[model samples]
Target: MEIQENAALLLIDVQKGFEDEEFWGRRDNPAAEENITALLDRWQETGRPVVYIRHDSVVAGSPLRPGQPGNDFKELVEERRGKGTGPELLVTKTVNSGFYGEPDLDTWLRGAGIGQLVLAGIQTNMCNETTARMGGNLGYDVVYALDAMHTFDLTGPFGWTATAEELTRATAVSLHGGQFARVVTTAEVLAGASAS
Candidate 1:
């Protein structure tokens, strides 16, 4: 598959709050941040457009609450934002899908003429997955950078616990091959970026 020259990189909810294992439970993909940084760096270097999605949870006791320290972006991502090497858009959301965020992700992408999106960030099975599905439905080419996202273990209503790794794998399996997004590794995305 070919990546568009103007494909936007959407970094969803790579916040400090996600570091709280006590709140989110055991997580997988320890190198997620590093992989996300790699993709961000490449985008910045190429002067590609980037959208930063922040989740400001309204749920009481949520670490991602607006006034909480955990609501801020991770240090590495924040530092990259400081460099100002590319076009940066901020989308703040209370929900899982970045498409439903403040400033209107779809409108902004349309106005900017970006038809393809490369996703990388936190909660592999939640925000990232939801955004990819929405993006696909909206007729945008979506790329899911699987290795660049992580998720915490989740307990189902039926009382079974699914490990983070399992969820991540399942999400990839469900989304790839024209289902919703093209699920691939960070290295593959970077290679596509370079080639595009």
Candidate 2:
């Protein structure tokens, strides 16, 4: 698919909180950050809008809670997080879906006349999945940058546990086709950025 002028890269919750392997517990897609960096670089070069979605956990003592060091954006994106005059938008949310919390990302995008979004970030089965679903439900063209997002193993009811790989695959399966978004690798997104 071709890139649209109104499309912006929506990076959700790539924060230091998720960097704690002890807490996250065996995440899949180890290269996710690299892929996301690649996309960010290309987007910057190609002049596509960039949005950074940060999560501020309402639960006290959570790594992502406000005033915590882990709540900050990961160091991998430090240089690209933007300073004065940079063409980047910083959006903060308190929930899984970036669109649903304070500073309503959906509303901001709509006001900016953005109608298409490319998603990348942490927890593929949670925040990323929720955002992609909302993006489609809200009538926006959404693309899932598959390799640029990841998730940790999750425990189900009883002793069942789903590996991160399984969750990632499930997310891809659920979002692909006409459901929520078209799942594409980071390469495709980078190519689209270059071609644009």
Clash counts per candidate, in order, are 0, 0
Worst 10 residues of 2 by lDDT: 79-88
Residue 131 lDDT in candidate 2 = 92
User: Compared with the true structure, what per-residue lDDT tens digits does model 1 show for residues 45-88?
Assistant: 87788999999999999999999999999998999884656678
- TM-score (all chains, Cα) for each model: 0.96, 0.93
Expressed as tens digits, the lDDT of each residue in 1-196 for candidate 2 is: 6767557899999999988888778999889999999888777776778888899999876889889999999987777766322257788888888887666777788888888899999889999999999899999989999999999999999999999999999889989954799999998877766643
- Runs in model 2 deviating more than 4 A are 83-86
RMSD from true fold, candidate 1: 1.3
* Residue 148 CA displacement from its true place in model 1, Å: 0.2
Model 1: lowest-lDDT 10 consecutive positions? 79-88
The local lDDT score (0 to 100) that residue 15 gets in candidate 1 is 98
In model 2, what is the error at residue 46, expressed in angstroms? 1.5
Best by the lDDT measure = 1
Error of 2 at 15 (Å): 0.3
